[model samples]
Target: MMISYADSALSVLPPLLAITLAIFTRKVLLSLGVGILLGALLLTDFSMIGSGEYLANTVSQLVWKDAALNSWNVYILGFLIVLGMITALITVSGSARAFADWAKLHIRNKRDAKLMTMFLGCVVFIDDYFNSLVVGSISRPITDRYHISRAKLAYILDSTAAPVCVISPVSSWGAYIIALIGGILTAHGFADAGHLSVFVQMIPMNFYAVFSLLLLLCVAAFSLDVGPMRQHELNALRGNLFDETKGQPPGATTDLPEADTGKVIGLFLPIAILVFATVYFMVSSGADSLAASELPFSVLGAFENTDVSSSLFFGSLVGFIATVGLAIQQKVEWSMLVKGMVVGARSMLPAIYILLFAWTIASVIGQLETGKYMASLATDNIPFALLPAVLFVLAGVTAFSTGTSWGTFGIMLPIAADMAMGSDSSMMLPMLAAVLSGAVFGDHCSPISDTTILSSTGASCHHIDHVVTQLPYALITAFISIVGYTVLGFTGSLMAGLISCSVLFVISIVILHFWAKK
Candidate 1:
């Protein structure tokens, strides 16, 4: 039974309630549950406001039936588990430590250490969770050796995590976005719409993510700093890596079976397997979609048409097997490997829990027709020229409030598509890019965001400290993105807009480099 609710301004209440409770209470899981419960109550027309019986029925039918039972959702769940296992096996086999030791031999200064951290985070692009966890685990020891502030390390980790994932078409974020946009466009009767082709085009227009990366490059290259981050870096220069007033986050010590430190292939092989396997599976699975679509198949086209679930599952599975196989070859016993897998899986509980609740909330939002309601409201009076910017702001707010970029994608993509259906392709593309950019922006800043949590957890930094140090940079990039979208709306030229935005981003970064106070 579909749990239907009135499609009006009131439909926004569920997500609003969830977002409110999350921000104030900082109890994300409980807050999201309450939000879903609130939506259920409203769906029942408030007749079941205080009735657990009604809420139970709602959860059983709406959340469980509609959201969790989906095969792709299950695939994501499995991928998360396998990824955790891979991380653990690497750690317990001493490959990660050996890799870290190898890095230490090459990095001579704090600047190089920070750059390398960011570079590794970008390179490991399979998933944001893995990026944060692995980069933080391996790089923290090296960063600490140079007295790099935990806050700075957290910022680098967080910056590279979501931004890189959002832009990389092969990342988990890519699969989610492709499915989302494709579904929306197909529903709206976009006859010639090729989701992958459009997705490939929007990469340049995803200004927040694109510029956030460029800004990171500038910051890393020039050693730029501003506001609180500058203070943190300066304090580190004085051999103070953390604030004395703040309680220090306890660092984790890994227990690993010894292996040869020279065997760096043990580390590189797993990651390489994950990337290569995913691409190979994607290409293989997409052969039919490619054959069916307008021919001349490209990598993005093949991937967008492919089975995301099977590819990701197979990729992560093979990566885990390769990792375990290497661990066994290193003379590590099965008992130790199994224990490490269990430990790694346990570490991901918080993020996994958050995704479950987020999926539930997204299901509730869909039931309420919140996205359609939003589309109707915005289209009624909002001018077409300003629509992209408005959608960008709306998406940013939703993601910031909900603390989930994927959730934001679920809620806002449909609305953006509805608004774009009748618009020209050139005009429509920026709107899509805006939705993506905003989702990433909001997720980066939200304290309850999984990426943010993982980033701090990975860096062994205080969570709030990471949020504080990262927000200014996120906001700056968001502002630039919003302005760029507005320009794209006016000019309607993808190339011109991207070039201008690129110039603006570099100028802003240069200004921060010399003028912004350290």
Candidate 2:
């Protein structure tokens, strides 16, 4: 049986220390590393790390093995590397430049450039990791030509990645969420309402995801800026994407390896193949699962049965093959292709390291059972009408502290499902929506979060700048989400709550824009 630490208040300390240090120091990597170290010490019952014999042993066992050497941890790192290579291949082939030129005719102004970035972000919903890197690389040139701030560009990339995936039922995110919810249902001996169906029902109720995209649209279309983003935008208007007199940092130096012939096809076709393959593999996996289970045929049924991690890896691999094959067809030599892949992988090395630390700290926190400890606090006595909002805060804090949305999902989905099955059953869908929305919102802001780091890397912006500029926007949407969840929890009216939240999002943004640089 799995160990439980639901009553242990010490469980939350590791992640809390990480969050506090990250915000205080603005050094995410160091903060995470120290947090993991502190967690290890705590795990040893507050043993001193500087003491004689235990130091090397603690560093090797906890930091290296327990955190980094885990299998799934390696796969996630590998996924980022492969995705980086694909983006690099696209850039090295001149596909990104060609796309930018093609976009020039249709994109005549800053709004057009921003809109294109926003549109691409929404369209590339296969995986959040893919979306951030691919969209940033492809859209940055256009945004740069129009003097759009890298901060804004990063915002567009960051906002779209997680929000789009959660709502996109065809994404790896969807499959993972389905499996999580389904596993919970099965554990509780209540599996009739398929995870996919429940997920679909909760879609409209996902206030943060839905509104985050909308807020991105508003920011793009209206040039809305607030807080630190306002300063960034104003600097961009003066041709300073960064607020430094050092001028813009030079971008990657990779020569085009292919002729401009079929540039659009070379760029977009490969992306489409990747998306289609990912969806195909996911659906295929789901279908196979359904067949083995002898379940009734339904679209949602297939999704609930899907294997997300396997499908993500499979789809990305196929996409890599397709992209390389497309490059050869376009007369690109194998040497240049290999070079591009290397360059791309190298570029992603920093991000991969950050992920390594993030996964490690999150693993340490998991070992501490932080989520269960928090969930234990959410007992049946809490009013159902307040549960969704409360759970949203809890999930958000948990995700922010741990810096892993997937980990948050794994922890919260089962707890939310159980709570729904308990006395306060009316809040199931709302609570479900709350958990999903909160995870994305928190992950969006956390400096150590993989998606947050990827968004900055993808946009080629300074990582801290991305984190600094985007947090206010994420918090605004999250505030709207909390209010929306509260309404939903109370009345169980998805439409009313969503509408109120939507209106609040627009109005609050507009008001903030006025308060910002115009």
Candidate 3:
């Protein structure tokens, strides 16, 4: 039912109540269920209050009529099903066991186990969502075999996922940035100009992305652990970090399984297809140019008309289905395959709910024009040079609170870009980069973020457990980014800012290493 204000309040009350309940209960699913029920109740209450017909309409509107139903939800669900099928096939064919066995032979040490994960994360930089799922699933067994903590695994997965994509040029994220920048430039009266090219060329100067990559590299290279991460590593080193639920079959003494070459090939096949298809669709969609080709229309004409997310959703679905079919052909049983698919899809339930809740919150906030309201509240007393940073932080806060990075970007990017119109062309790239970085920064740390939930689920750790463990690391990176952006604001040299941030980041890591040991 379309809930009245009082009924809506009653409906929403349980989720808030659940949050408190979870603190005492530590029951993740129960907490999530409470939240979900609250959402349904809110809809139901509305319907009960002289809006019976509207209730069904509201439910349909919220769950089905929304853009999420047509796009993000379907894409996520499709990927989950695919992942499940792949997992079932691997388990049935004993490929997971085989891979674990191979890892035992080569990755004898804990540090190597962690490094391998970080490296794999870098290689799968095409999509943050894909990277989180693929890297975490593939590496989980190996890491567990080495007694690595799920908390640590979650940290590695989270760190590498978005950071890698924000800097990569071939991913869907890259396309979005290009399109946004193009729009921003044209809106600023720079239409038909090469402003976007200038922005792209200045990416290496994006201190936040560059420094983030360096931070990840340093963590991998030095094995520098701090806060909860350090504790987790120490526990692993003491041979007490593996989940009791994981490891070899009950009778098997060795934790690691023997390598199966066929399993590895099978695993890579779907991944390769997904990557290739993503790139192809991205290019064909006219999001960006990989090479020069002459046509009757403009070179960028394809992207001009193509909807990037639509292409991504379709391409990913196709790759997912193809991979599932291949797994079935490999003798994965239907029942077990279905079970795996169910589990995989189940893993995403928290994310789906969070997305839906976030969407509603954002939709409500938009109706009130919250971002615009906030923007208007910023007085003329604020320095013009600091406007970009202020907007960046504002966007970050919104995303953090709402736990929806795209929604945050949708509101703040246009505003920030508009504010930067009168600024130097060279400054626009860094500013935009700052906004993107801040959005990610907030999403990474927000307990409500979908990626955070997925990371926790993938690692089989408590969602809050992952959030608490990774907070310190995310904060350190964010601090570095803030400083980096500050430098960029004054100097307008992206390269200088990046270099400075990288050097400082290394020093901070060194400090953390000593502190962690102490």
Which structure among the candidates has the greatest lDDT? 2
Candidate 2 per-residue lDDT, tens place, 1-518, comes to 12344578877777778777877776767888788887666666655643223435433443357546644445555656677677777766677778778878888999989988889998888778778876787788789888899889999999999999998776778867887777776787767876667778889888889988888888888877888888888889898876454322213324435445437677788777777887787678888988888877666566666665566667767878887888788777678888888876777677766666776676677767887787667777888788889888888887887777888898888788778878566667688789999999889988878888888877877677888899888999999999988888777788878877977987898787787654
lDDT of 3 by residue, 346-440 (tens): 55555455455544444433333444444443445767666556655766665565455666666676766665665555566666777778777
Root-mean-square deviation of every model: 4.8, 4.2, 6.0
In model 3, pairs of residues that clash are 1-43, 1-44, 1-46, 1-47, 2-46, 2-47, 3-46, 101-257, 286-303
- The 10-residue segment of model 1 with minimum total lDDT is 247-256
Off by over 4 Å in 1: 1-6, 46-70, 124-141, 144-154, 165-201, 223-262, 287-301, 333-338, 401-426, 446-468, 491-507, 510-518
Show pairs that collide, candidate 2. Answer: none
Q: Is candidate 1 or candidate 3 better by lDDT?
A: 1
Error of 3 at 80 (Å): 1.4
Q: Model 3, poorest ten-residue lDDT window?
A: 248-257
Give all TM-scores, in the order shown.
0.77, 0.85, 0.78
